[model samples]
Target chain A: MSAAERSLRGRAAIVGVAESSLGEVGPGISSLDLIGQATVRALADAGLSKSDVDGLFTHSAFFAQPVLTTAEYLGIRPRFADGTATGGSSFVGHLWHAAAAIEAGLCEVALIVYGSTQRSHGGGLVASGAALTRSWETPYAPRIPASAYALAAARHMREFGTTREQLAEVAVAARQWAKLNPAAFVQDDMTVDDVLSSRMVSSPLTVRDCCLVTDGGGAVIVTSAERARNLPRPPAYILGAGEATWHMNISQMPDLTTTAAQESGRRAYEIAGFGPQDIDVVELYDAFTINPILFLEDLGFCAKGEGGAFVSDGAIAPGGSLPVNTNGGGLSYCHPGMYGILLVIEAVRQLRGEAGDRQVARHSLALAHGNGGTLSSQVTAILGDESTL
Target chain B: MTDNVRADVESLSPETAPGTVFDRYAAEGVLAYQSCGDCRQAVFPPRVLCPSCGSDDLGWEPSAGRGTVYSATVIAPRGKEPYTVALIDLDEGFRMMSIVTAGDDGAVAIDDPVTVSFRLAGDEPPLPVFAVEADR
Candidate 1:
């Protein structure tokens, strides 16, 4: 079954989406606490209780565990449980799997959840000295994520004449959107000077270009289109979803500047029987400033080697030709470790016109894309109006 | 103080380090990569097996430490000095990221010749540094 022929379009809809307190909640809160809160909230939004859910999916890397942990915490006994861990893309992949499970009659409803103590507890993205591979990267000490990313940035600059200012522009645009989002972390008035003056975490990448570590959780409830008609909000129909991995090591990649999102996004569009032009808005996962630039190209928004410039001229800003990452993004919004889940939540909100100040007018279709690993793995999902169902 | 001496002096020691692949290279001075017999492909970041072939039949191979800069970035500090970092496309086909030295003549161009060196920082192993490969 090639993705282009999948008929899952509009078979399922996202009825509910919720999030626990983003940023630092408190010292006493556990990762599980955030997960439980978001799940309960999502179920309540769907007007369903624990007893109504028969399926569940969560990131294996995240401790959604004890099986009984989330089920007991939410007071439900689900017949289906999925702990698919493909890094950051876990949530988007779960949506597809949940849809299949429901369509296959394995369960009536599925809850996909994610949570992390990345900020309050810290040590989330920090390099561990114990990993055996550290020995190789430790000598030159170029193994830190920023330095590693610089290697790719250097390649992009050499290959396409991408400039530091071009990369800085992405940070500036994200900050502009962040200023509009009440939930964003680094909402201070940021300028190109602020980005250039920022301490270098890696060459071509500044600490300012990086995302904030946060403690947060987001969850969504999925069910048949028939059930979605009765939910609190209009359902955001699942048009299509797809995921893939290119390479694990940054050095082994055929091209550091390009991402697997190209293939993932292509497959997703084909599955939904839509094209890139059909997308009215986007919620691209931007863990780092360069991520979305690479994503913009991979998703076919512009030709390759034009990512750095395509973002220029305020094309992605609120009033630009294409409004992206409206709820601030992983770059500006709270990035709680595996932030891919939040993209789905945000996309659904925008499509439903629920985003107060960040909403894009008449958002008929939205693309939610997530990058895992060091831009090694990718997941792209296309969502549309429930009337399409 | 002088370009020659600074190029000789190593940076980044093991004492102030993390568990990274470079730490081993710094301490051993061996440019090692993951080689899969199954796929005849050599990889970096020291994977357990070949991601291409999914075979655990993999071994660490020492590189000759020879390559060319696939790309480079020369940074002019906002209020500080300038430095360069590069992606060296190794002879083994894998790429190694390191600070480019040996030339203060502006930026290193793509395909520029480079060889591996080490920088000693604190108690940590000497960090991997690259110098222009005159022969290339």
Candidate 2:
């Protein structure tokens, strides 16, 4: 496709990706400290220096103007800048926006970064709830995203015959993946029973079903496809990406069991000229156990009501037919407020065969999906190594 | 953008905006939603412009006070009384988030028919909650 066209597959590539100190960094660490650390390492991994950067994309709870703050911190003036913050999926949306900028020759060496210290600062639960825009539901003290998500989960279960065991399977699989990843927040063995028996925070979802509150930051470096090919690390080519949102409030969503991932995934796949079966590995923003199931169905991996069954029998776990969230995902991995950046980092690692023990055998095309708000913003990206390109 | 940000960016005057007008209706012990004059679409959490039609000519309409529970959940915070929160679809063709005052905790479920119940406490602003009514 032409640069002027909407499609941007293989027009830009992710040259480097890295993460800062994960799990917990203590009270002394700030969100910018992690962002700076990750930026330095990520630029180095891309075989590029600070002077080479011209485009900057970032999202954070720490800055009202994320790009401007990050640019001043890195001491560089970017020709292009964006600070679009739509919650957790903000970073993933950055990837799509970055590629478009590159293809349009707006700038070169785009940096997409994110950082958070919610766990270290404490009040992760309270802060998460407060972050959600409240109104009619505020008086009732619904646990913000968790309670909102539980409402959707309950409806899905009632409509599709999905059981708590099916939901627990997602957490168990994430824990299994966590055991192989040292950077994971929790690496202990977990089972369906364990997840089911864990403390219930919101009905239809237990504490175990929720994502962890941990401190971490991650960054990705993007450049033109030609430049990325000459970088030190194997380029994770941007095959296709798409973003869509239908509602901000959980109650406003048209359907409880469905999400906007359906539209986002379809747009991404159409742009990439490929479907889910072509993807080798999958990385989904699993903020809650029900997230993967909902995304799986909406992303066309399975029929709408079949997500519960598709995830059962170790489907997305390490010894399974399909590899997912090899870096442990938000469920067992570190979730530093916004998790979209980590999703991109994990996909790039898998595509480049840098995932170590958790690496999938056929590491070519990978799909990363990010969810923000109460399943509000959905951004899907399809990335691949040079082979697929 | 988050809805909060959108609300702020497109904020209306206090006499017409979501927060104030809705508060005024609550103070008078009634539930109201915005009805677009152009599209006739029912808008909850009122907006200056009709989200469906981009029409600025919007007016308020009182709800018939009955709805169906589209979804429900119980937030069981530690050492606190669990309460039911639900997404209710009003018969007037709009949906809203509300508290479900059921006979038992976690008793409300999807598809349950409910009616509006007022919680008009002293000093605090009156708000609407749903009562899971027994089948008659």
Candidate 3:
């Protein structure tokens, strides 16, 4: 493909990626403090200084002006800033925006960061039942997040004959991966029966099926491919990026069995000139167990309604056909509200051959997919080694 | 129904644009949805402009009060009685979220037929909850 055709392919790369703290960071630490720490660490990993950053991107429900607040706290005046808030997938969307900005010569170095104290201060991921429109649904006291996702899980089962065991397999697979990750919140073995017997937060979903509510933050530094060569770490070149949103609330989703990942993944694959088979590893957001199953189907990894079978028999487990959520994912790893940033960080690590024990042998081409809201927003990013680029 | 069914409803303020009209219809024990006068399509949550045709001509119409359960989930908070929440696909081509009360057993399931029922929510209007159809 021509450079003008695939504008972002190999044009911009992730030079550095790091996290502030994996699990608990205490209640005393504010979100801004975590952002600052992660920013400093990521820049240092890239062998760059704070003065080299000219663009900033971040999103937070706790902050009114996320980008502005982060820039001010870091003592740097960014020439370009974006505070796009579409739930967890906001940071993945930022990667594409940053690449576009660099392609347009708007900025040379872009820093995307995220931080949250949800576990310590915000009651640990419980749904408050606060509705945006006070629609007819609010009076019934619906448990948010869980209830919202359960609706989709129920529909998927009804339409595809998906079994509860298939959904439980996703959780088990993530825990198995978490065993290798010392920073994971839950690093123990989990069986399908263990997941099934866990306390039911929402029907078809147990407490084990949900992501952890912990205090954590991460940052990714993006710059032009030419500039990335001089950085300390090997760059994970951007091969493709795309984002889309279907609905904000679960009630308004056109279809409960599907998500916007289909559109977003298609656009991303087109830009990369590669298909699902070309991907060697995947780092998909796992706020809920059903999310990865749904993404696998929607992203064209398997036929529609076959997600249940696709994940069965250790398909997504380590050493399986597809190694997904190798860093334990949000299910067993740290999920501080918006987990989109971690997905990209893990992908960059795998592409750079620095994923430690969770590393896959063929980690040249990787896909980092994220889901925001109740499957409302979707973003897909393709990261690859220089050879693939 | 048992006394401990835990189907308590809460009322919301009707000062907002969307709530003013939706609340008025709920108070009358009618399940109403917005219909675009231009494209003759149905819109949920009641908006002034049609989302499909982008026309400002929107009107309200009483729904048939019947739908099938698209999906269902039971919320079981610790130390609290579990309640069922569901997504209902209306016959008129609109989907909504609501509580499904299938008696004390609470046996609502996907694809089950359901009909609208009303329960008074404080001083505000009566809210809609789906009851599993006897035939299902």
Candidate 4:
């Protein structure tokens, strides 16, 4: 079923997008401080005040009662609050929830926020005590997040003959994009050999194949499309949004080679009345190198098992047919634990024609997809210029 | 059940969680999984309700302890002994993730036939593992 009949379609628009100073923010700074800084900057960018926000949406793997904490810290009692913690894609999911809230007259403006001090606090990717899977799966081997993705990568290579070079191309392309983004954590030039030769975290996944860990935070303001016209920047109209969760643990995944993006993307496209060929820019979560490849295939950008060849020869580079992750990605951009929020922020910037160096020729329609857990949860947000609304 | 194979298995204690029945069976050197009483369908990592039929009437049943390797990865950290982790599709119908001991060579591949084994670490009960079938 599609959201064609739902009023939420084309009803909400992103009015503001901003990020805290990327890269190292030092040890004294906490995630709460980052959230406050980004929230103020984003609200200012939207030409809205903290009092204008009646809805709040945020998630934290490290902090408990995050939505309440943000509300109390920001000192704005929100009528609507959502702390839907589904890993990195929580922010993308929040967009859909906020849109529904606005359409139902529950709230006028919503603030979606995320922050992490993983680098400054020496926090690892998987929160130290967060038990993701069953106890049975943990004793035999360490259950680090990369090892989980490594299992899927191994299965995909065995089933489809995907080579290491193809996976390395993802890292290389991300670096090329990062070179243009001043806020990117690592903009150094890299080659396929550099990725292939990096220290192996898991079989078939090198350190380069993994995303960088840094302290960063980002926020976006969403409100009714009618109110967005009076805002400071061009509003990125929300054409369609979809989210799904097939499994929580990698072991329980029905198919290792495919992710839930198939269902989420299909729903989003059906609602938007558009297809893969129509997307002008794409920002997909790249927590691992294998993620974008799987998302490309599962989202119907390419045929099944053909993602290896689809991404070769700079297909996703800045001047390519489909520009993906224009502000770099989790692979090169800042990955403050959950990288989903950053994806939507970049999509909004691209759709608004604000992406300075890595802007695509046609910036009307953009698709931002986020993968949470071990490719277990998938969320797709289709943003477009106000003209499309 | 193989009672004489105590030393060959890991001696870790069963986790005191909702699904310790699976661990109880593992500690006894018998591989068992939960089966719904209504649908007779197998469920792994034991849950209170059957995912397919939504029946809470579940019972434990012994498995043949054999399956194929759905996927495998060698996690070789620096200065550490490398071990192979795999997702084994059990013969009874459920899939599980566990470490694989492919003899001294530690050689394993996808779709290889495997048999269930057990290993102990610290004070925890024996955890189920997989080993490639010798003839395969």
Worst 10 residues of 3 chain A by lDDT: A126-135
The window of 10 residues in a row where model 2 chain A has the poorest summed lDDT is A125-134
lDDT of 3 by residue, A282-324 (tens): 9998999899999999999999999999999999999899999
lDDT of 1 by residue, B7-91 (tens): 1013323431222443564477766666777798876655555667877565556678888887665545567566666667889
Q: Is candidate 1 or candidate 2 better by DockQ?
A: 2
Clashing pairs in 2: none
Per-residue CA lDDT of model 4 for A242-317, tens digit only, reads 8999987788899999899999999888888788999999999999989999999988999989988888888997
Runs of candidate 4 with Cα error greater than 4 angstroms are A2-5, A126-134, B1-18, B103-105
Cα miss at A50, model 4 (Å)? Answer: 0.9
Which digits, one per residue and each the tens of the lDDT, describe model 1 over residues A232-299?
78898898887888866565567888888988988888888888887888888887778878889999
Residue A232 lDDT (model 3): 82
**A169: Cα error in model 3, Å:** 0.6
Give the distance in Å from residue B92's predicted Cα in candidate 4 to where it truly belongs. 1.3
Deviation of model 4 at A134, angstroms: 4.9
DockQ of each: 0.25, 0.71, 0.64, 0.63
Estimate every model's Cα lDDT from 0 to 1: 0.76, 0.86, 0.86, 0.86
lDDT of 2 at B23: 68
Interface RMSD of each: 3.7, 1.0, 1.1, 1.2
Stretches of candidate 3 off by over 4 Å are: A1-5, A126-136, B1-16, B103-106
Model 2 lDDT per residue over A14-64, tens place: 998899999889988888899999999999899999899999999887776
Model 3's CAPRI class?
medium
TM-score to native of every candidate shown: 0.83, 0.94, 0.94, 0.95
